[model samples]
Target: MPCHLILSKLADKCPSAVLAVLDSLVEPPQKTVNFKPKQDAVKQEVDHNEDMIRSALRAIASLNRISGGDCNLKFKSLMSEISKSPMLWDKYYSIRNE
Candidate 1:
């Protein structure tokens, strides 16, 4: 009946499908740790993976606050990965709650 319930059921039969759908919803950012688009965009060195982890954490925290459900997310790194998809990123960025 609800989206969360639907997502839970979908997660049981197809994990990737659930992930893909979620990714399309939450969306992801492109900037890495150094606040640059690509390797060449920044002059200084940056730990891309570490930055991704941080950003994902922040994103999840925001989601939890907005959703008002203490989601207690276990794997934040996944959000970083989802944010990479162009379709997902664009859709999420464009969406407005109000």
Candidate 2:
């Protein structure tokens, strides 16, 4: 998870400098599929994506704080998505360890 995303949600009162540092953490090495929104209205979907990212970062940080260890990137990715929806988080966690 990106640090900015974690800080954005956990400490909304954080300074822009923290935001800037978080921004720098987003440089992932994985290849991504380019998504093209068909309409400007779909931009909200993009914003949601950003929100999801932020949420997940928060969740990952929370998980780390709770577990006291580094979460694998794959687990962090799943944690991020799960954080966005409580139902999904419960469902995922239920099935994840099985």
* lDDT (Cα atoms) of all candidates against the true structure: 0.42, 0.43
- Any residue pairs clashing in model 1, and if so which? 28-83
**TM values, all candidates:** 0.27, 0.31
Give the per-residue lDDT of model 1 (tens digit) for 2-81: 43344445545665554544545343432332244455655333454544534444443334333322232423444454
- Top lDDT prediction, candidate number: 2
Clash count of each predicted structure:
1, 2
Model 2 Cα displacement at 4 (Å)?
16
Which candidate has the top score in TM-score? 2
Q: What is the lDDT of residue 6 in candidate 2?
A: 53
